[model samples]
Target: MSTVKDVTFDLLRRLGLTTIVGNPGSTEEPFLKDFPKDFDYVMALQEASVVSLADGLSQGLRKPVIVNLHTGAGTGNAMCAILTAYLNKTPLIITAGQQTRDMLLIEPMLTNIDATSLPRPWVKWAYEPARAQDIPAAFMRAYATAVQQPAGPVYLSLPLDDWDQPMDATDVLRTVSTRVGPDPARVTEFGARINAAMAPVLVYGADMARGGADVWADGIALAERLGVPVWASPFCERPPFPETHPQFAGPLPPAIAPLSALLKGHDLIVVIGAPVFRYYPYVPGSYLPEGAELLQVTDDPDAASKAAIGDSLVSDAGLFLKALLPQVNARVAFAGGPLRKPPQTPTGELPLTPAAVYATLNALLPDDFVLTQESPSNIPQLQDQIRVRKPDVSYAFASGALGWTTPAAVGLALAERQSGRNRPVLCVMGDGSFQYSIQGVYTGVQQKAHLIYVVLQNEEYGILKEFAELENTPNVPGLDLPGLDIVSLGKAYGANTSKAETTEELAGAFKGALDHHGTSVIVVPITRALRGLLG
Candidate 1:
């Protein structure tokens, strides 16, 4: 009889989970004892980075990736990242060690207390095997649940000593449907409505990109067929449509009243692959513009249910776009000039404006390069200034958390290697957000992951300050961070580092990072301006 570890590894290999991301501990040693030479283990310095790195890899690979953590303590460290993964809709199989079964009642060191509940609400499914032999079976369930429609993280707890347990292994390989197709009648009805409407606007989100290249093309084709203006969803975490497209009308504001006002002229508002609305700051107003009807297509039941007002079709974004394409007519409304003008490149000024940085990057960045951005205070400029010209080229935080993207840059670099695309990855982050997962740099160095970190150092939490102003709160303490040698820190993590105080220097630093094979950090001290939200 094969032992649990033997069978589990075989299963994992078959499932394409050969690369495991983890931050290990004593409780996890048994499972990792004599790790297979054929398998690769990506070790992060902290559990938070471990889970987050895996999240990026999963998204890049478009599959479920397994992550190992050190029992309860490790899970606690990774909870915030798990939440990020949940919001990102990335498929991850998260496994953690539980103290030996004999110590469960005694609650000894590293013994998980309520293990299943730890990652809950965030995870689609969470479970600890009922017995040692059940561990392999549990993983299968976890993988299936993780990749189902509206993919997200799943949790499993394995006892340390259970790896050696006797188990009779049999072929457990099976294939499951990963996408939910739109209901035929509902889709036909949606098509009819689109044809009947005199004016319709298409709003899209990350799912269009997540659905893969074919799906992204379908989105552009569908938009062409309908001849409708396209608006990006509020706080969209990925680029579904090329920002440079002529029909693109830019992003919609997140608040309720303004969001409706922007769509007011359209008789039909068709939102697909995103939530009906993702709003913030609690601006109360009509859910939809007067005389405008809304229809949403999404893979998530939760988003469909929580939608304030909309007729929803639960379906894969790509499938719905494909199905509705032939039913619609090619119209002349789309054959027009650009809906928005490109921001003019800024002139070099002292202590460069955020627009200058974005404009410089916009000019320098390669068409195929991938960008992960987290500079919240500079979003308005980043949006109007920077442009994504390719499909699946942008990613950002949906969980409103810091530190995810910096480490995610590393994972994306690894993903590039795995996929043989080897695209250069640039991570744009604020100074305050850099500290949250700085340890990820060390991991990147060890892995020789090639990426760049462009830090916009304003010496303060500009986003938080903006929020305070919006909320009428003042004199907030501990907002300023004046001292830190980021150059030294980057060097300590074995990265090439540079600082730029002028636009010319900034361009040089960015170019150096692009040419370098490994990690680099370019810190630029920008003008400190707290641009208010919706500015």
Candidate 2:
């Protein structure tokens, strides 16, 4: 019989999981020894960065990636990234090493007590095989569960001794189907609502992006054909519709009242791929306008069940949109309310406002550049000034995790490079978020990937300040962060760095960095202003 590690490699190869992202330790060393020459192991400085890097690669490559982690401590460190992956529905095959089976009951130093439950709720499935022979079966099940509809991370705990034991051939050869189609009846009823409504609106989210460009084009066709205004889902990190399209309404606000206000006039609302709505600040409002009806199409049953005001159909977003398109009538002119446009703001001197910074970048944006953002306080202004004309060109942290986008951008850049795409990756993150995974810059520098990092150094927790203003609370504690040199930090990480305080300076720095090869960082010091949900 072949050894467990050999069979595990075969199974991974069969599943096309050839890349591994991890921050390894003593417990994981046995499994990683003499790692196969064909496999790529991407290492990260921290466990959080490891999982997040895999998250981006998985989403970018449109497949699952394997993640190896240490015992309990490493798993604990990676929990936040796993949560982010869960929220984004990214497929991650997360495996953790455990103490030897012989020593598990005796409570060896690094044993993961109750290993099976350690990554629960965040993963689709969690397991620690009862016997060494069952390890291959556990991984097969994990792969299937992770790639299935409503895909998310899956975890497995393998003891150090397990990798040396004999494996079962049959378990490694098992295969499973992953894709699921929408119910025909529910799809027809959904089409009927679209056909009958005088004024209908479409709200879509990241799930649509996961369906590929064909699905994105189909969604645009369906919306245009139905003459419905399209709104990106509230708090969505993905671009479901082209932002530059004339029919495109802006993003739905995270606040309940404004969101309700925005949809008040639409007679029928169809929300696809997103949760009903994700809100911030406790604002009370009706779930829907008095006479309006809501229908949601999603792949996750949990999202459907937890939604506040819609009847939901569980289905793949792309399949549902494609099925519904043919049932609608001829395209009608948009007769609903006027679409919202970003307000024009003056670009004052020296210390530029957030809007001005966006304006400068927007004017200089390259045709082949991709943006990964994490500057929460500046996002509203950023979205207004900069527009994504296509799907898969922009990414952000849907889970609101601070460190995700910076490292994720690196992974995306690597994937884009490996795929022979020449797009330059741009990462815009707040200074506060920058520190969370700053070591990722070292990876980008070492890999010589094409990337530009823009740090919005505002010297305070601006989003929290805005929240304070919204809640009418004064003298909030721990809101100010003064005098941190992000440019120096970038330079220390081997990135060519510059700081800009004026619009002219910003434009110069941006132009210079974009023209330079490899990775560069441009830090902009801006005035801290609390606009309170209004951007």
Candidate 3:
């Protein structure tokens, strides 16, 4: 006489989705009722925060995490956050409570009128179970869809009244292969293409970073043996290679013209684990330099199909690296300016510069600390100043969505505790982006997630203003954001707060926050300067 909830709980327990993450509503109570004592529930005040938090947790754990949302309203709230999860290639099983089956004829209040379609184009699969007895099977399908290659979030809507009406729950678990072995012929062909190119470059993307230490070693081996320069993919959510390495060229500009120009001299561009290009602000030009050819290796078939210019091989990044490594011939040495010239260090006068802020952070931060960045205006500055050398230690919203980082930081801190890694987390956010998921501060405090938030208040949407200048659009209003008191906001949520306007103050505040085992916000007012839209 096992109920649907009972069978589902057992399945969830077996799946290691024992810790449920989300913001639930009345419709969800039936599924969550008398929540199992062995399971834990992580709640967020906003639906968007919940989704992103789950994303971070999943990425940190390197596993599929389950999240619960309230039917239509919650799903809508989390749509953009869900998109970030999708682009990040993080595995997530998203479940929503639906209106009772009996009430569907009348379309009752809180009913997900179009539940199945609401999260479309972002989620891989979205379904509302046909019957109460089918809930457990639907969950199984959702999990399988989510964790498969090109891992991403999948959705399932369960009617509120369906939790108790279930019968069979005997044998439902199945093992599935999450990685695809590289085709030996394709691998040989890809290696041949690499070996044929005279002047080649490697562009590492987020998925390569997702492979952690083992894959990073293989990537380094491949690059050194090929005697080629390495560039991180533009606008990558996670940088694939160590920034401070000798062969590292700086990040490729995330615009069409500039990206093409940067790769102008290179005859072949080999992109691994990232899109061929991810651009913003519509920079039109050739997809590649005049004589250059492009090859993309990625797990996501969608990325390969959508690439504007590239020969693609769909394979697991780690396996592809290992398979291709031995076939390529070693070169004497890369014969060009192997690394791109870095921008000159900024000298500060009175108001703070973006580079100065990042430089101070870089100088003072410990090597082991994790950085979650969402400061859009200062992305290039931070990437240049900060060296991301470790795998799964740096994260940004792949979808270019704000509000995901702060909550993500909290979730990552929680994951660190669970894994006993317990590396301190540092979240760098723009003041404008901070307010988008400000409620994350409360969640951090409640969950005892020790994270330090460094919010740079530039008194404007600086990146947008840069975009305005580039796009030559006149009189775009709402570009300036003024009168935000992040210190007060942080304090209201029971977090330790500080304001650091000077370098000395910044160092002290950062150290103090780092030493404390709780949530802290260090707000800094920075002068606005545009580094161009592509940066």
Candidate 4:
């Protein structure tokens, strides 16, 4: 007979989870007893920061990451970050220590009102094993569920008392099977329809990256052969195509009305990996253009099933791309006009422009660096000024959640270090969002990870100002942030800091920070009035 701790460690090792991220609590002491020397534990101050770090590691490493948490309270604390992981479709196996198996019936202290339902709709699977012997198998199941198509987070509630109980550990580890290609007839029909269309647009999603660059290149080849322009899905977490490619049409419009209007002239809209479109609130428009037809190819069954206006085929993105490659005839030449350029920044001295900052940063950053963007007001500017090379190098919170960038950057830095990669991790976060998880800076400092945090100090919730103006509301509450020193905050977290009021100063600071060995923060003073231009 083996103790639960031994069994859990074995399961984790077999599952390739040598790294664990968590904020340990009193209830988790039993599980933490006799911690294995082979595994590395990444400790964060808050549970939300723990999960967020794990999320970024998963995306950067392209592997399932394990996260531990305290009981109900810890799970609740991590819920927002968990939602962000779900939206980003990151593969994570999250485990939380329950109060105790024996005390569960008595509703003891720190016991959740409903443990399984707490992470609702965010996790692919949530469970509490009935027997102590079942813990190992349950862990394996969580890993499998997390890595399955439409990869996302899974939860397990581990009772503390059960860790000391005897349990058998005889189950062998098994490899998860990859998804097969779509039906041959369906592929043929899709190819034929695409060839028949006058103007077909290819919208690539993040899933394309899951299949790797070879698959992505194959898809791009097919699209090019068909004379189609490739556009990234709205709010895309991955780069559907190399932004440097001539065929790339850049990111889709955030508003549905404008997006629908843009697609009006196209005869066929073929979306791959991503959904038809993701819209924000108050975005009014029909699902599709009046005469245009829609088609979807995705590895995610949910995305395929829920498509409002398209024929969907469920299959591995790479396999589908390979199978469809030979069926389409090559066009004489790819046909597409110049890509749409985002609004430009005006030269100024009084108020700083977000566009200028992004443009300068783009010029300053090396080609190999990774960027984690959380500045909602600078979306258009960054997307326009900085062209991404691939999906793996860029990440943004799809759930519209603030405070995700700080911790996520820590995770990416950790993953990069673990993989022996030398590229710098650049995190662009707004002043408002950075305050949410600034504690993560300490984690980066502790790990001695190479990270540069660029705080876009706009001194207010710029998005709210846009909302207020949109609604014609004159006065808004809680929109202004004044007299805050972000440089001091970074210093408090043990990070090297710099403040830049102009583009030239910012460029100098960014260049210096990128070469720093440890974590560094650069504060760029921006103006609230420049926010609207990014839209």
Off by over 4 Å in 1: none
User: How does candidate 3 fare on TM-score?
Assistant: 0.97
> What tens-digit string does per-residue lDDT give for candidate 4 at 145-209?
88888788999988888888886666646778646578899999999998888878888887787
CA lDDT of 387 in candidate 2?
85
Query: Residue-wise lDDT of candidate 3 within 85-149, one digit each (tens)?
Result: 99888889999989889989899999998888999999999999887878888888888888888
Return the number of clashes found in candidate 4: 1
TM-score of every model versus the real structure: 0.98, 0.96, 0.97, 0.96
**Model 2, 2: alpha-carbon shift in Å?**
2.2
Which structure among the candidates has the greatest lDDT? 1
Q: lDDT scores for all predictions?
A: 0.89, 0.85, 0.88, 0.84
399-490, model 2: which lDDT tens digit per residue?
A: 87788877788788887876788688889888888888888888778777788998998888888888888889999888888878888889
Clashing pairs in 3: none
Best by TM-score: 1
Give the C-alpha miss distance for residue 102 in model 1, angstroms: 0.7
Arrange candidates, best lDDT first. 1, 3, 2, 4
Per-candidate total of colliding backbone pairs: 0, 0, 0, 1
Give candidate 3's whole-model lDDT: 0.88
Per-residue lDDT of model 1, residues 300-352, tens digit only:
99999999998999999999988899888777757778998969667677688
Report the error of model 3 at residue 4, Å: 0.7
